[model samples]
Target chain A: MQEVLRAHLEQIIPLTDEEFTFIESHFILKKYKKHQFLIQEGMPVKYVYFVVSGLLKLIHTDDTGKQQIISFAMEDWWESDYQAFYTQTEATFSLDCIEDSVVLGLSLESYQTLCEHLPKMEHFFLQKANRGYMALQRRLLSLMTSQAKERYQQLIHQYPTLVQRVPKTLLASYLGVSRETLSRLSFGV
Target chain B: MQEVLRAHLEQIIPLTDEEFTFIESHFILKKYKKHQFLIQEGMPVKYVYFVVSGLLKLIHTDDTGKQQIISFAMEDWWESDYQAFYTQTEATFSLDCIEDSVVLGLSLESYQTLCEHLPKMEHFFLQKANRGYMALQRRLLSLMTSQAKERYQQLIHQYPTLVQRVPKTLLASYLGVSRETLSRLSFGV
Candidate 1:
């Protein structure tokens, strides 16, 4: 568990063993079965989870009960309804495990404590946030300017691992298109 | 001029007089006449300019020379083709002054050097970058989900001063709509 956490931290910033130990103590190891809901809309999101080995989906349901998949996270990625989490509001989105997986959970209070105790950790979080914002910007632009085919191609090319792990229907949902449209695009010549 | 710059810096993080002096040395006051381009597409963007006064527009053009307004910066706001500036590539966007204005220019090299030399400055820049990213995220979401009138309202609500200074045509361009549409919306019974 420590090794997995250390590996993830090392990708963003080099952490000393002591620092890693300090963080490890604060994190809670969580196990979830496939298709399990980690969070649901209208409930408060108490924790942000880092996926150690599973796939998670961040989704939102409209008034009509139509789910819009905002994002998918594979191993080493973090997932949360951050707007809700940070603001201490009811969740605007839901999180569910797509595959049976291990996760490290960090509560909002614990994350704040870490930021106060370790400036480097704060820097790492800030960098991750910036990158997330940048990627989302590009994704929005693509969604507006490109067709479904182009968006699909970009997605597969960018996150082939995610494409491989998820079903075509879920992928279609993530792409904000009908499953039939995805099927036609995939098999239509 | 120094007061405005100091106020801008304080909004993110407090700085000592010595630190402020260090930052002050990096800025060069530049004046632009109305209709003059501050930075043009395909050119190397050397500096990020903070508007002491006046209006600056950032625009992106397509292959056929049709332009799309991306953003506008007024007093206390900083403007630059940051992606191009950071990557050392030719700019994909253009910045032009709509009214004669004074701007404090900080060259990319100097700003980078300061970030390396001053940890506080680096933190300040990181936080500012985070804020900029957030604004861009909101803009993209509005563009994707909101109608033209909604976007126009959002823009005016955020920057009423810019709304007053910039003309209707430019405002229409910024909202991704036509001059006639904006006029109709503004005057519709």
Candidate 2:
């Protein structure tokens, strides 16, 4: 589990053994059964989790209980109510495991302590944040400009693992299209 | 001018006198007349500019020369070809002064030197980048989910000064709507 986390970190930033040890100590490993909620909407989110294995979905539900998938977390991906985590607000989205999963979780307090003690870690984290921004920017642009078919094509191209693992209906929600629309786009249209 | 710049810095992170002096020395004051390009597309972007006064537009043009406005900068705002500035790639967008302006420009080399020398300054910049990501995320959501009218309303509510300073057509482009659509949205249904 530590090796998986360390590999992801090393891909972005070369960290010293001491820095790696600091990160390892803060993370708590846990398991979740399929369809379990890691976070729920309107609750105060205290922890951010990284998927060590299995799958999770970050989603928002409307007044009528229709869900909109915001993001998917596969192995080695980070999942959190970022706004709630940063601002101490109630979460607007819930994070749920779609499959039985192992996760490494860290509380907000411990993350802050990590930043305070290891400034270089903050730099490393910021680099990852920049890459996240780049990915989000591309997703946004595609959402704004692409047709349903185009979006489906791009999604398959970009997240082949996600397409293979998650249901088509959930993928349609993430793409902001109707399941029927996605069906046509995928099969017929 | 220095006082105004110092005030901007204080808004994000309080800079010590020595740190302020260190940054001030690295910034060069640049002036641009209305209608002149500050950073042109296809060129290597060497500097990121902070608006001291007046307005600037970041624009990307289509194959037939139809312009899409990416963002606008006003007083105290920072503007750059972020993809180019960060990666040292050829700029994909052109930045033009919408009005006569004075800007504090930092070359990539100077900015790197400052970040290397001042760790706090590096954190300060990283925080700004995080905020940029947050803002852009909100913008993307707004663009994807909201109608043009809602987008225009949100824009004016957040940056009324921009409505007064920027032209209607550019604002339309920025909102991802036709000029006619913007006019109707602004005037009626």
List residue ranges in candidate 1 displaced over 4 A: A61-67, B107-109
* Residues A1-189 of candidate 2: C-alpha lDDT, one tens digit per residue: 899999888886688888899888999998999999999999998888978999999887756676667789999888888877777899988999889999999898887777668776666667767677767766765765567888889888888888889988898888888889988887853
TM-scores of chain A across the candidates, in order, are: 0.96, 0.93
TM-score of 1: 0.83
Each candidate's TM vs. the true structure? 0.83, 0.88
Tell me, by TM-score, which candidate is best. 2
Q: Residues B1-189, candidate 1: write the lDDT tens digits.
A: 888999988987798999899999999999999999988989998898989999888887766677777778889888887667666789888999888989999897888677667766766766676567657756765664567888888887888878888988998987878899999877752
Interface C-alpha root-mean-square deviation, candidates in order = 3.2, 2.1
Candidate 2, B1-189: lDDT as tens digits:
888899988876788898899899999999999999989989999899989998999877656676767789999988988778878999887999899999999998998788678776667777777777767766766765677998999998888889878989889888999989998998973
Best DockQ goes to which candidate? 2
> Per-residue error at A177 for model 2, in Å?
3.4
